[model samples]
Target: MNDFPWLSVLIALPLVGAVAVALLPRDRETLAKQAAFGISAVVGVLAIVMATGFDSDGARFQFTETHWWIKQFGVHWALGVDGIALTLILLSVVLVPLVILASWSDAERSGGVDGAPPKGSVKTYFALILALEAAMIGVFAATDVFLFYVFFEAMLIPVYFIIGFYGGPQRSYAAVKFLLYSLFGGLLMLVSVIWLFPLSAKPVGEGGLGHGTFLFTELNTMHVDPTTAKWLFLGFFVAFAIKAPMVPVHTWLPDAAQQSPAGALVLIVGVLDKVGTYGMLRFCLELFPGAAKWATPVVLALAVVSVIYGAVLAIGQVDLKRLVAYTSVSHFGFIVLGVFAMTTAGQSGAALYMINHGFATGALFLLVGFMIVRRRSARISDFGGVQKKAPVLAGLFLIAGLAGLSMPGLSPFVSEFMVLAGTFTRHRVPAIIATFGVVLAAIYILWMYQRTMGGPVREGNESILDLTAREKWAVGPIIAVIIAMGVYPQPVLNIINPSVHHTLARLDRPDPAAKIHVAEKVAENGARP
Candidate 1:
């Protein structure tokens, strides 16, 4: 199993399925959908197999395979996984099949409210989805910086079409905005990637490249001057922040989410957006520790602002899809905060939060989508006493909502607690401010529920049906996992701790408590007779 090239198989399987789907007659929509779902399911099972075989005690990249891809520039087609990458990869694979299942029927629906049949072939829709899955796996698993960048940029293409071709009236605008923002960031990162190559080319004997490679292992050992590292760090950070969709840059998300299909929105917000926070951990902090430390104050501030700003905006949203999108901005803020806290506990919490947020948010989007389909409207005002008509659906919505607000005994609560606790130990003021975001979370969630599900059955809502077998299957595993992770996070924490320590070691930044302890020891020694 060690030499089986599981990573390559994982990356390629979906693409193969995509090809198979594309080759089928364009009119064979059902077959195309089935093939796509089957492929994603197989990939999901393989991911589980890979996880079970992974070394939880190991800190270094595992299941690694490297082959020179661009020897001219010393880049390799390197692939591997550490605890962090593995967690995100698991999130990506697990969600893909569920998204496919959720979309099975929706893909056949007409484009928008009161619109004609979909303009594109269902085969193409599912094909693009499968292709997106492969790119996501590559993004998380790639060990080569150049290879990572390639996957990173390639990811945008399918998502662009998914939104533009399958989305709402404003999809074209949303798709264009998303692409421009992503491309701009990718360009900045490309500059940084190019700059690092020459710096990494020099031999290690002369304090330069160890193997003249883009492999993270080789690059981790190469040191850059402080000024240059900071510049490069900005190039990478800006790209990630945009992807993270933090505040000012977050405008695109609500538009994109509103225009996109619910299933595709699941991947957009759940796995795709994670690339930003993931990159911050993988590239910004790992490769430029000095710059990370230097930029900490500003990053933390933006994170805090995003937390508060996104929640407040969510409270004001009339569109259900757009509301969920804004809430993600808030959730992602916590993720970034945890990552930049520079503590082992904080980083581990951040990693777990990424996974938990995916489940929680995905449920919210899908459930809300269920409501929209029934009402044929996205307006929150269009719903009222929905619970009275569809008690089961309302119950599921409550579970997802409770998880979203980080209520106790749900997956998100555990991770959110860890993030806050860890951040408090390092930066009390920021932690305190972030807690207020949680308060706003409860306000928005409960308020939205009251407006949409509570009260007497509204006239239009009385005829609505409860969740179908398919919808139940779609949400059952998510709810079960949410409760299970909340009760027992140790399974995930065990996998996360080793890599968290490794990352902190690379940063060379001691825990705040450790620094305080050292200071006390030095002062006592100075006072000794």
Candidate 2:
């Protein structure tokens, strides 16, 4: 059973679904949506079944399938997943169906959304969604560097159209900016990936494998000089940072999120952005440990900046979508910070953060999307006292908002706590400063909630309806998962810890033990007196 090509099946199912969904007549918008949702749900279920078969302690990468796709370049149609990759794939599949459900009517009418007349039909909108889901799963599952890159770049297409044709007025500009930034990053990564080939092809006598290959496991054994490794690391890191949408490079995200449909934005920020941080953990740290360690200081500094800057900016946004977008920028900073902190707790926290952020932010975006559908506005001032009219909607928004802020007994809080705790164990000062981002998170999430869901029921908001049965179904699972994970995270951690330890072993680093004992001693000196 384990030998079955589960990952390929996972990828192919969604692609076939996309084609099937697309072939539906344009007039059959409802059928198109139902077909898309059903397909995504099946994919999600299949992924869950695959996860059940995974033995996290048995091997670093499982469900292995390796066949040469390009013999000349030694690239393989390899696919596998470690704990990190498996969890992320799960996050992607789980969200796709819900996104489809949440967006059922979002594209039904071209004129209803804020964009210029829609250029794509409703069937196309849902088809693009399924296509994006396929690419996302493939990227997470690919263990070959070249195959990973292929899936990485392919993900941009459906997303670009989803934004460009079915989103807000500025979607064209947003999609263009997104494409340009991504292509620039991807080109650099391609250079680095190409560079790895010759590095791997060098003679074994010269610390090389004596043959060209892009299989991740083989390349992990290849040796490159520090200078070359640093350059290669930088190439890959920049691409991921842009995707992670870290500070400076992250300018593309807010614009993209602002222009994206609520459903697409959920996938963009929730799953797509994660590819960046996951790349850092998998490729940068494991493949270029020295460069990763050397680059830690600068990366940590930038992560801290992203944390504070994103939160501060989110607090000030009048546009509801942009505000949530900025909060993601801030949330991602924590993920990056934890990754570079380079400790077991830190990296594990980083991995878990990716999943938690997906559900937390996804729910927020969907609920907000629901609000926008009724009011046809994304401005904070455009809403008030929504709780008076739609109590259930307002209540769910409050829970999701609190989760975003990392309030206690929520999954986001658990992940955030682990990140801060992990970082503190290794890098204290940056961890301290990054805590301010937490305070700012509270301010932004609460302030936005207060403005949109609080106060007297504004004249127009009085008639705003509660969540429909379908919307409740779409969001219910996420909320349950959040609470369940928040209360007990050990099950997921069991699946994540083995991969993290193996990655750390690859770096030849372990938790600094003697020094921690010494630090405790220093704190105890003369303290009893």
Poorly placed runs, candidate 2 (over 4 Å) = 110-115, 202-209, 514-529
Model 1, global lDDT: 0.88
Candidate lDDT scores, in order, read 0.88, 0.89
Output the worst ten-in-a-row residue range by lDDT, candidate 1.
520-529
In angstroms, how far off is 271's CA in candidate 2?
0.3
Q: Could you tell me how far off, in angstroms, the CA of residue 192 lies in candidate 2 after the best superposition? A: 0.2
Q: Which stretches of candidate 1 lie over 4 Å from their true place?
A: 114-117, 204-211, 514-529
The sequence of per-residue lDDT tens digits that candidate 2 reaches over residues 140-212 is 9998999999999999999999988887888889999999999999999999999999888856675546668
TM-score between model 1 and native: 0.95
Measured against the true structure, the TM-scores of the candidates, in listed sequence, are 0.95, 0.95
**Highest lDDT model number:** 2
